[model samples]
Target: MTGPRLSTRLRFGAAALLVAVGAAASVAAAPDLPARMVTTWDAAGEPTGTLSKTAGMWLVPGLAAGLLGLFALLPRIDPLRENVAAFRVHYDRFVVVLTAFLVALHLSVLAVNLGYAVDVTTLAVAGGAALFYYLGTLLPHVEPNWFVGIRTPWTLSDDAVWDRTHALGGRLFKLSALIAVVGLFVGEYAVYFLVGPALATAAVTAAYSYVLYARRGDDGSDPDAAGRTAK
Candidate 1:
């Protein structure tokens, strides 16, 4: 409860529980799938290539397991492990939300396939929007780390650069999320709303970091050097 205090054990436990739930859902949905099926839409509600019934049932749960495994391994492998600890709570919550997103996607797919009268496209779009919004919320809190946030050469090379880049990135990501939400009403063009803003943010942040780094020089000068000298 206090600043995302769940231990690794707890996080793994949570992931396992979700895996079980997903497995159960797959079982429940199995009867409905054609012996040989083709997936038309991914969980994000976007059109995709086809897959067999077996692949469809196992997809989300398998992905959930793999992602959880990756999350567990990231901290140990990161160069800035302490920095990750500085915002471990945020990271943990992000993982939880991601896992939930996957679970929700699995359910949505199952419901749609089973003729439950649910809209797969709408569910996918809404889920993606939620993830984008939450990711935006977490961006500013993330410290400089190898496996997360706006990783760039400049941001990784200097703390000052990291801070400024993340500040800009935070705003842009939040704005992107908002655009994605609005995109829902735009019909087929909604993917652009989700993707375009993200591309712009990535490009802008990378360039901004480069510019800031260059201005600071190789030794990392203070941006307020002139003002400090004047005083």
Candidate 2:
């Protein structure tokens, strides 16, 4: 059966709550913040760049709103939207998780600038690990679609390829999340832990999909299902 559509509760409640908190914090902190605030950090978690106080405060909330909008829109625009509905419940939860991650990061940044000794980078890496781990759980349940999962030339062409590749992807992503979490304690090298594993998972999943595609072709499976799902 197709999964339920994106939850109105998520859209109006959890997401709204996060955005509201971000905005409220921005308002409360605006007076004490400098005209420009440090907003970028290097991989080592050192502050590297700045943004206007107004921009700094609103950045994540604005981005979150945009992302939530896009997430809500994708199912309508996708050709394989029915497949998206097949996992819509998971999809909605993913949206909430991602928004919360951003909110956490935004709050960390605000606190650090306020003289709190928050290790913003450590918090970011940890949040990333959580997000990636949840994504791992979500992948295997994804039906073939243009907007999500391990899309590749091969996976999009065949349902069997999509399933196997996503299954592999699900495992690899979880492993990546685990590896990334170790970065939380590795000091300056922590960001690399997340980046390295994530990149490897992407490369491995794409290659796996292609290999599955070619083998299926050799085995005489139809390769003409392209328009249904894939990049």
Candidate 3:
């Protein structure tokens, strides 16, 4: 089922909330801290950073919320609204889960940067956990649009393409999640682990679309065909 449409006023309100949160976070804590800080690790599991106490505490979550709010505006935009429902479920769930994860990550950063005696490695583990959870949420939908899911020319052209791409995407994202989770244990290689799966998925999806199109042939069945055949 389609979700309720958000009005312009509501959208503006959401944007305002994000701004307020960010502004509040900027000023919330220690008044004498710097606007930006660096992160450092000492021998005793403490995070030393150039961040001011107030700024460090608010930076991550506030930024995360703001970015998410920006993303939320996409569906309401002109071009995106055209196919908003194509992968609505996946898209919505992804946003929520991802935003929540970002919030957690930011909080972890805050704890460490604020000299709260949190382990840096523990933050890494938390990030990995969130990544895994996000993968689980993304793997089960079938739709094609500019954002979320797999977007290939073929997938955009045909519903069949959309379905097949998402099916493949689901598996790839799951695999990616697995690799990323494993990397948490491996240490340092986690960046490679996190990125490799997605790169592989994009390559596979692109190849799959070419093969599908070649196999399907050039009939009116091609969703890209804009005109109808004459009787």
Candidate 4:
């Protein structure tokens, strides 16, 4: 387990532990903590709405644990189990990054609840950029698993489709992350930078994969299938 599984377990375990510890600390600080805590921040850097302390403390850890468990089980349940094994390293790293992001988010909320001076928007933009960048890095190495990457039927059925689609997707995702970072400097409209790019990437990649698949015809004689699509 030292090579891959050990690291995987450690990544997931650490994330859950970190968040759980934070939650426990929060409760310790105020055992009678209100059912809801105001965690939201506005452009003026003020709290907006009250979030359930009980919810904020445990929500992310629970979600992280559930998702990690699913990631661990995918290989055993997927019909393309061998294909997943081909890029297990990339897959594992993706899971680790995701867990880290969740922890970051949980901490941000915890800090706000603890009355720390925090720029919630800045934290969100930075965290989003990092997560998107990692997603871009992961897209190309994905091997059509049921749980990750572009999972259109075309990508799943044809390695060529999957390769080409993810290649394009990786670029778009990286570009989206850059746009999100730039948006951090913008005013109230900064959210568009994050939302717009993500939507465009999803739409374009799904359409591109479908087109490529269709181009392959019923017999799968597309140029990509013949290994002529350039590496």
Computed on alpha carbons, the lDDT of every model, listed in order, comes to: 0.79, 0.85, 0.59, 0.78
Give per-candidate clash totals: 0, 0, 3, 1
- Predict model 1's lDDT versus the native: 0.79
* Cα distance off (Å), candidate 1, residue 35: 1.9
Candidate 4 residue 208 Cα shift, in angstroms, is 0.4
Q: Estimate, for each residue in 33-107, the C-alpha lDDT of model 2 and write its tens digit.
A: 888888888998788999988899999989988888888788889999889888888888888899899999898
lDDT of 1 by residue, 107-209 (tens): 7776666666666666666677788778878888889899998888888888878887888888888888888889888776576787788889899999998
lDDT of 1 at 41: 64
Once model 3 is optimally superposed onto the true structure by TM-score, how far is the C-alpha of residue 159 displaced, in angstroms?
A: 2.2
Candidate 4 TM-score over all chains jointly = 0.85
Q: TM-score for each prediction?
A: 0.86, 0.90, 0.67, 0.85
lDDT of 4 by residue, 43-140 (tens): 54566777676776777777877887888888889987887888887777777777777767667777766667766767777778888888899888
Q: Tell me which of candidates 1 and 3 scores higher on TM-score.
A: 1
Q: Order the candidates by lDDT, highest first — what do you get?
A: 2, 1, 4, 3
Query: Candidate 1 vs candidate 4: which has greater lDDT?
Result: 1
Model 2 scores worst on lDDT over the 10 consecutive residues at 1-10
Model 3, span 176-205: residue lDDT tens: 777767866665545566667667877997
Candidate 2 to truth, TM: 0.90
As for lDDT, the candidate ahead, 1 or 3, is 1
- Which is better, 2 or 3, measured by lDDT? 2
